[model samples]
Target: MDLIAPVVLTRPAGRNAPLAAALRAAGLAVVEAPALKIERLAVAPPVLQVGDLCVFVSRQAVDACFDGRCAATPWPDGVRAAAVGAATAQALRLHVPADAILAPAEGAPPDSESLLAVIEAVGLVPGRAHIMRAQQGRDWLARQLQARGWSVYCHALYRRSPAIWDRDTCAILAGPGRCTLLLTSLEAVDAVADSLRRQAMDWPATLKLVTLHERIARRLQCIYADRPADALTVRLSAPDEAALFQAILASARSA
Candidate 1:
């Protein structure tokens, strides 16, 4: 039988447990090397009033928004919460009613474009909209909302810094063993590339990457352009955990 490669999960710190557990249960060796460390910013959560639309850019945004004082207050009735992806939507459910949350259809690419479609379908008259997000990120969604006549307000709830890999983790990545790296965001792709450069390590010919979006895959392709065409492989998967699991498993088996 062909040997399966170890999977390296590069999500933010504290966010890899569930996926790592799932992969391990399926008999795959897992490495948790967070590409980004999330730091909650000292920002007050926006007040939700009726007819207001609150958008969360990521699950971390949702968590930071409702961490303290925000948790004590109930989500106002008639206020709609929007999530850029299913995971973010799930997080929002803890603070808002399920019905009050808007998200893309099942299996649709979990992205700002997808969420914008869902928001448009509801024909929500352009009104006050608040976006809870990190210190820096793509402003596509906010720009789109503003173009639609929505009074968009942005709240920075957290900041992301590149994580430093430990010696053991660095050894694994630089070792000869087959490995598959999972990247979920454009920032993560850059973080991983930066980390590898810092170690003066080249992309292992046997290494494969699985990313959640075409844009991220393209970014990876650009970053590793100096490597031989066949030295690195990039695959795209849906944002959901199940899809990511299958993509990682397939990449491992392909080795």
Candidate 2:
């Protein structure tokens, strides 16, 4: 693995500003080829009951939900909001108070499991809850909440369409350097792999991957198993941008 390879940013355009800036600050070449184009859905917001819980799977969820259907509607007085991680929690704070938001316990992993643990700790055992996210987001959290006897209302706030493979995106994937791809979502990883195939390039052979979870890594392995060159994949301990940069630097130094 070569250190300081060109890093491909696959996050949605609206959400990649901070991470892209940080990557450039670390002296790595960045290719801004978004894998998914987020489109807000035209849906009616559900009324919240007292003691109801609302979960935002990602920052995009918060933005899509509030900026679309719930633009003028205030959050119900006794309803509480929850986010999977600090970034999403920060996004929630833009529309709701810090005290009204619930998140994974500080120092705990920022994931569905941790968020579920926190919800259970706060005595949110049963009642009604809402899960706001992309159209085809993972359903594990919603299923868990339902298992706990909560009436889970899944609101598809946005739709994630595969991004078009423009000339610059094609060049980045087919470039000569040992490029690295930053994949934070499984859907984005699949879109990128499909994009490479559509561009007629041998994908993942000379490319390294920085994925947020082992599930995404497993998916990549399935995609690149037949390829000859083994790609280096680094999985971070956390999903935040700080941990992502640290993992990138550590991988670079070790290489």
RMSD (Å) of each candidate, 1 decimal: 1.8, 2.5
Decoy 2 TM-score against native: 0.87
* Regions of model 1 farther than 4 Å from truth: 1-4, 70-72, 166-168
Q: For residues 9-88, what per-residue lDDT tens digits would candidate 1 score against the true structure?
A: 99998888998998898788898999999999987888777889999999999999889454468888989999998888
Which sections of candidate 2 miss by over 4 Å?
1-4, 69-74, 226-230, 252-254
* Per-residue lDDT over 92-166 for candidate 2, one digit per residue giving the tens place of the 0 to 100 score: 887887888999865566679989988888886588888988889889998888888988889988899889676
lDDT of 1 at 161: 88
lDDT of each: 0.84, 0.78
Name the lDDT value of residue 110 in candidate 2: 66
Worst 10 residues of 2 by lDDT: 229-238
Q: What is the TM-score of each candidate against the true structure?
A: 0.92, 0.87
Task: At residue 61, give the lDDT of candidate 1.
Answer: 93
